[model samples]
Target: MLRVLLRTNALDDRVRKTLVDTLYTQPTNLAIGAITGVLCSLVAASYAPDRIFLELALLLTAIAAARIVMAVMLPRLRNRDARRMELLYEFGAFTYSAVLGVFAAMTVWYQLPATAQLLMVAYAIGYGTGIAARNAGRPSISIGQMILIFTPINVALWNGEDLAHRALAVAIVLLWIGMISITMTVFHTLRDSVAAAETSARLAEKMQHLARTDVVTGLHNRAGLNHYLVEYMSRRRAMPNLALFWLDLDKFKDINDALGHQVGDRVLSEVAQRLRAQAKQEAVIGRFGGDEFILACDVRDRREAETIALAVLADVTRPIRIDDDRLEIACSMGIALQPDDGEDLETLFQGADLALYHAKVNGRNQISFYDPSMSRNLVRRREIEAELRLALQRDELSIFFQPIVDLSTGRIRAFEALVRWFHPVKGELRPDEFIPVAEETGAIITLGNWITAQAARAAAQWPDDVTVAVNLSPLQIKAPGAAMGILNALREARLPAHRLELEITETVLLDHSKQTEDFMAELSAAGVRFALDDFGTGYSSLGYLNKYPFGKIKVDRSFVSGVNAGKKSDAIIRAVSGMASTLDMQIVAEGLETIEQVQAVQAAGCTLGQGYYFSRAVPDYLAGMLLARERERLDGPKRAIA
Candidate 1:
């Protein structure tokens, strides 16, 4: 038992409980032990009753036993740990005995002769000294210490007188020990329990903090942001002008693709640091996910809001160093002013998203202010969204396949399926007129899936050498389960990925790092060809070419339009086409309306061209007729009649 107690750590709660329970049950055993000790003392004293020695011993035994029993049982009845309660009970027990012993010492001096009193004093002194020395090694200082110090002095005072006086003095020493024991047991128990409860409360608070704070960057996560947002918005009635700045890092995927994910995480940490550095005191910044972050602040004026936006743009655009490489990471910020954008959270959030889209469209790495025109765009988008749903149902939409030709060989390589909305009221609505709306409303996932399936089905009927190109919205790719949807669509259509080319805009590769990388890697591994569509429009074209895996780059219509105009735009076109060639990527120039535009693209070293220079986007039957005419020409006699 001693070995086991020595091996057990006292702080272990299980061991402590066992020790307390032992003390609680000790009251019964203590009573029997005390009675036995008293009877033995009486037996010895009966032989010398005149000496009064047995009476003194009996009195000491009875008082000690009664005090021990009361100290253990009282706290147990109160549901307290008996070990803790016993120490507190002993304090009072010892103090009371000290006063009683003094009173009895006076009585002993008055009653007994000198020798018997001296004997009583010596016994009391020895007992008290023994008790104090034993208890000093205990876990706490109880009433035993007071008994040790005072009982010895009281014994000396009584023992100076007669034998009768010695009996009273010993009885008083017993009473003082009992009183001290009770006080120590009760008070110390209360103190220990309070301390334990406070420690537990502090631990609980720390756990709550860890749950709310982000482990990596120490910023708030989506859950924490939502919690705080709800708390702040609860005071929305008083603070009406709450602004939400939805920020997405520009070309973040390109960085991840060029460097490893570890470096990408480092860049993200830096981005978070920049945000906190640039943020105003009132701003609450949090990571939404990947390279996306949110800045929520209560603003009262437009100028102040714009100032914050500019500061954020400036800070994020600063150069970040990872090992030896210094990278300039930029962000596109979209501002949605509250109550003006919407009275509620969801609508305001949508408005901010719309602004972000406008920022990327106009030119990324810049901030775009929310305007009423955004609402007009949203409305137009909604109408197109409604049409988009009904277009397939009512057969108002059809695929128009435009042939992709090799400029040098003049041979058809692929057919790009462009969707046209033949609106009943608004006749001949082109994709540009409605595709944005479809993407915004999250209907593009369905529309894009259909287009991929349709393109695959068409490619299956064509020559093995020819491929089908399908335009995919960034939003479609961003949505969860996107890769699964693409895979299932291809499998259902029974078309190999090699026969399908997915055209995605440069903006799609900007942010949403983890999602974009996963999607591209999965699809590319499956053998589907990808093209960087509308290049030279967003933040960085050359950077993307060097970063992502792409089969082709389609020059945006804006650059193509300017290729005919001046040296500046023409130089840009030439440089872009040359860059693509150097990278071993095919160049497809969009919006080739005239012979000059086509010739200019060809002059710029562009190999593939798609525009009205060939033919406008026509109906499916007309496109098939065009395909048939081209095939027949290839199979027919040579053009030279020498």
Candidate 2:
């Protein structure tokens, strides 16, 4: 039992180290033990005055002095091998207890003076108790010390012929048992506490990591990005030049609408991987939100930032394959430089966002660096967006009509309704000035609905044969209840659905969404004709013409302008007109400003024309007057026949 208790293997390595360190933590405890042991030895020698007693006294004195010296030097030796130091401390403790035990036993066995014997026994018990209390962190070592000290003294008392001495020995044995129990309890308590603390620390670290990581892309999330910014800013003096790049995937929404969100998530993950591969090792990258990513990296100047931005754009635009689909995606990047754009994260983010907006507005899949003018433009846009909201509520918007003429009869077929904002302070604002802002800010839904209703009401006032064409924004087409809303507008105006023609650009077909298909199908079933506007300006696939129920295809203004001037534009118009004729779709030549251009489109088989040559867009009153004039002209021929 003693050998087992003395072995160090019972405690874990960490617990053992902590216990050993605790043993030497209090030099005052070591000093007290040394002083008491030396005094006890001297008292025994003074009482006995024999050769063995004196020699034992001298040896105990030497050992006590050495323990004192060790305690004094402990601080200097703390940096040395811990295991060696722990062994040294244990050896010194055991030797001191063994020597004191022998000295105490001799005082009793030799029948020394009663005062000396009592003193020695009392000293031994006191020292053993002290060891139990002080060294309880290491139960084995503490119990071992108590056993060595008390066993010899108890043996000497039990060997005596006196009854009182044996009773004293039993009492000492009880005391030793109690001390051992207490030491074991203290050691277990301390060990369990350390284990709990370590466990909590590990749990806290894991939770922190989870909080900072993005689940979808396995990159840093917004919170993680904030953390990175804080840490980087702390060391900003060392790294003065930082380039913040904001990236947005162009037409990613089309992908999500056409495919699904699951595919969108996969694409985002792939994009993250590509960014990781292309970014510098020191760069901190994060996914800010849907389809948006941010990167902060060290760069010397705008030139280096531009170079990196171009490289990233090139790599990201490469084709990606998912399942059976080969998707080619493009990314627009905006860069803001540190100290030049802003010193902190908030300002830097604002600058980068402004630049990104500029890139998207100019053309997607390009890079823009921050400039002061972009900020002014952003402010102007915000003013427009805010005022435009009020404009909708205040009825500061109106519609104008551009007539589409039939080339064969030189008469009006339909009038396209175009929205114009008459700002009180800014006068009449063109659609191009505020329409993009409305579309981006989600105000187009309400505005587009208003236009549809107003156009329906105005068409009711026009000649029964003249139809009203209203252009639909991509947002308006994708909005819920869009078809129902248009039908409601026509119903409220008492206008037949046949008189309402909807003009849509090719962008609406890019999504290939079920909602859009359903929207078109519902409206088409209600006798609302659909025209493919700006037909050749976008993804001019003949597939759209075949898939969608388009009654008319309007040649883009660019092609109409080039007619009779270049063979390319003329050839494109001729081919489109021939295809439309085959599909039984009317072809309208747009942007015609000259008789020669009009004749060219007529000869190329275009049945209709609309441009400045016909008439610029006019208000509803003027449109009604023009329809009345056309009606009178048709009546004049009929009256002549009468």
Candidate 3:
């Protein structure tokens, strides 16, 4: 019996309902046992003289009321997980059944009528059966209930001092033993069924957990993220102000390819841990697989979301170190604010994703928010990227020539070749729009080679003294066969290398790679002069001027545009001009939009000038006519002086 009570742990392992169901029939047994006790009390009271019925009725009433209370409370406890409370209900039922057995025993001890004794015997037998039915789920408790109901009655019958009573007790004891055996069988059967059901439920729950979890980071998986987003959106009808940030790890693939996946996996885990630490507890952060992670938080507006996005981006870029190698990671975040970006999760995420594309395109490791204008821009960019591919093959691309004049004489000494795209359907797209798309798609290589060929051909057709300047993208300078491409174009067009000048931006000088250095060296060695374009706007150091052999420096138009404002602009131009003179390099002052601007650059000792003040970039045929008129003007003066 103590063993069964100590098997509380076993009961804990069982389903809550198993124990609850075991007590389902308990209420009925309690009521039936109490009724039998009351009936026995009534029979005793009726037979007794005057006052005996009062005490008897009072005792029966107390027992019946207690039984009624327990019966009501026990049923309410069904499916309750509290095992001790369940055991107390079971004990109450056992005690009530035991009292009923004592009632039948009392009939033999009190010398009641022979018919009454037979009735009491029958009542005890019925109560015993009820015990078996009620306690089947608990074998040890059933044994205890059976003992309480049958033992006292059997002992009283045997102690009656008659052969007939003794024989009746023996026969009833045999039946009682068989009931106990059946109770044990039923108890084991019920317990086994409960265990099996509980095990199955637990297994299913574990499978669900595994499906929604990421093994590497223990964060929510992509499916889990989607599930969370669905739950969040469902509750966000009237108050749908949430920020969704999609972060992509910059240069993560390089680590995976260079250091093996193990190192990459470690890095990803670290990133996840750091992000979790930095995010608010209510925020939902999850891995969307690979190098991308998604974070979401409910906020009032874009400013709140932007703050979170910036914090997350900063968190993501923290350094991760393994062994001796420390990797500085960077993340670009695209933010979309709900109700502002979109009401639904799908539309919001799409906006965020497009913004992410712009972040990576504009220069990575930064955060950007979604704007309606971005959608239009993205559409146009997509159109340009698609058409630019076809434009290279279809020869739909053309060129415009802007003259670079000698600052002293205003002679058109050279023409800067600018590429223009005339889309068949979208009309003419500017270089800023299509060139970036082409560069992103690696179409710049083909486009660049074609530009070189075009420039060389045009320069070959011009006067031998006139030169053509072509701008080079950073990607072009980084490419391996860039010098070869330009050299071949010049050879094919029968143009002299001296007549073709390649202009490069400060970014090309800052590449720091041997590839960029070798490319510049190769082209310079082949007689193609280099001009530093947008020199002062970017990180133009004096060291670069001494290191790279540039034939000239084009002062960025931003400073040139501000020339008339104050001496500040003139001061910068003078400083740049002085540096160029010391290095024995020419200066081409760009963006000379006014005669005052031209005069400022000329006074500041600029060797060349080019802007709208001279003439806007014009078509090839018009450029040739302008060049002819300028040449005639310069020669007419030369002939008069001679």
Candidate 4:
């Protein structure tokens, strides 16, 4: 039956091996059967005192000794050929049964004393029953042994003339049939159990695979990567050095926003394919969620890792065609080497992520290796982020106002509110030192709202003609209740909506979501004004001016400082000023420090200017005093005429 199952492919190799292992598991049973047979043979020989009886006893003794020896050696030979071992066990069992059968048949054929014949018959029946129970897992061998033991004894009785002998043969035939039936039932039950266990194991393995794999890109997810790392690190001594690479797609959010999520998914899949193509045979690649991929490979040194990263960069940057769009993408990579960067998965991930952040901050579409300084910088940034949260609650935050001057009359038209942090331990901190941290930690929403209310209250105290402009963070603009928050601030301060100007950069327009549109429209309908700050530095589009309610444009400092430098800055400014004029929007030239820059911007048709040449940002009290002085200067000539 076992052979048939194997040849027909009905039983798995593992399951067959498991069944075979059960045959030798009961060494105690083997020892007991051998000793019982030898003792029975000796008793039978002593009673008969015949040549055949003595020879049978000797044969039984030799077989018993040989079986005992085989059982003792089975453990050492277990790792050798499985089929040969199984056959050897079956041969020993069958030969012992055949010898017992011959001993029983000889007693019956010779018409020996009833007591001796009954003793031999009883021993053979008991041994056959033991075989049926103990070796049921392999029914073919066990049942064959039972047949060999019973058939000869039954035949001997049938050939005798005595009616009692014939009756005994009939009863033995019935007993043998019952034992075979029981053996078959037990074998079927064991085989079914093995099959069920094998199926459950296969299902569990498949479920595990699905759990570790990414559904979208068919790559390993974070859990799978962790599993691989754990297994790899366990055998690190025998393997080459490991290099972990963290990769991020540049401006991927812009693609998702401009196109759709469907396109974004396709782009991610294509990127994963490219990564797979470039990866080495020993490399393990995974998606770290959202436009980010992680790769770990065996490398000899940093140079080998660098070579792989460069090849990946080259392949990934190639144009990918999806539908009618030919999208071009770029990725930045960071590498961390084993032992040098970290010894564990979490530390390696952190080091590689820090290096990736550094690459992105310096410039995108580049590669960077982990450095100890990057970790220090990360510690510092974390400290700043924590301190900033407390700074808000402790009232360490204050606002400063920079005056915007009207170029035609050289009079202050408005003031742009800037936030300043007065740290108790570090003195005053610049916005550049902490704003990015605030943005990342989501502290900007509260901080930006506070600035809005403070700026509105200060502007309410200024001359009615002067408007105060406050910059809006992208997060703040997208935040829920942002429009209501701004309106509440104005109402609390008794400031007119038109007297408060909101400044936004091109980043805010990237989403092109209805929420932003409604936020701007809600405030604009309430008589509030909007300005496009840092223009010409980002995704500057004339469509933004038409699509949004922006009434003013501030040229970026880079362009303003380059004015009259015999570069294209002059032409760019002139072009922007012309476009703003045609659209009836005000243009402010920022970062003006010299008369030459002011003159150049004025020549380029800028109506307003802001920078150190005009006045540095000052506190609310100083701004109020400047406004009072400017009011007096304007009225001085009017009083003389009256």
Provide TM-scores for the models: 0.52, 0.83, 0.69, 0.90
How do the residues 1-642 of candidate 1 rate in per-residue lDDT, one tens digit apiece?
234234332444543554344344546554554454455444444444355554465565657666666756575464666456546545544643453344234334444444543444444444343344333223233334455445555565566546754665566667666644544444335435644776787898887767766766777878777777777777634455888998999878888888988898888888889889888676777888778888988877777789989988888888999999999887998999877888777787788888988998777888887787987977887778877898888978778788777777667778889887788898988677787667657888888888877777767777678888888888788888988888887888788888888888876876646788889889999998899888777465467776677989888888777544556667887887777778788988887788887888888888898877777766556666777787778766665432
Q: Give the number of colliding residue pairs in candidate 2.
A: 0
Which of 1 and 4 is the better model by TM-score? 4
Count the clashes in each prediction: 39, 0, 0, 0
lDDT of model 2, residue 540: 87
Local distance difference test scores for all models: 0.70, 0.88, 0.80, 0.88
Count steric clashes of candidate 1. 39
- Spell out the clash pairs found in candidate 4: none
Which structure is stronger by lDDT: 1 or 4?
4
Model 2 whole-model lDDT (C-alpha atoms): 0.88
Instruction: Name the regions of candidate 2 deviating beyond 4 angstroms.
Output: 1-16, 24-85, 95-120, 155-163, 232-240, 245-272, 282-296, 300-334, 353-372, 407-410, 560-567, 581-584, 592-607, 629-642
Which tens-of-lDDT digit does each residue in 272-303 have in candidate 4?
A: 99999999876789998999999988888888
Error of 3 at 237 (Å): 12
lDDT of 2 at 442: 95
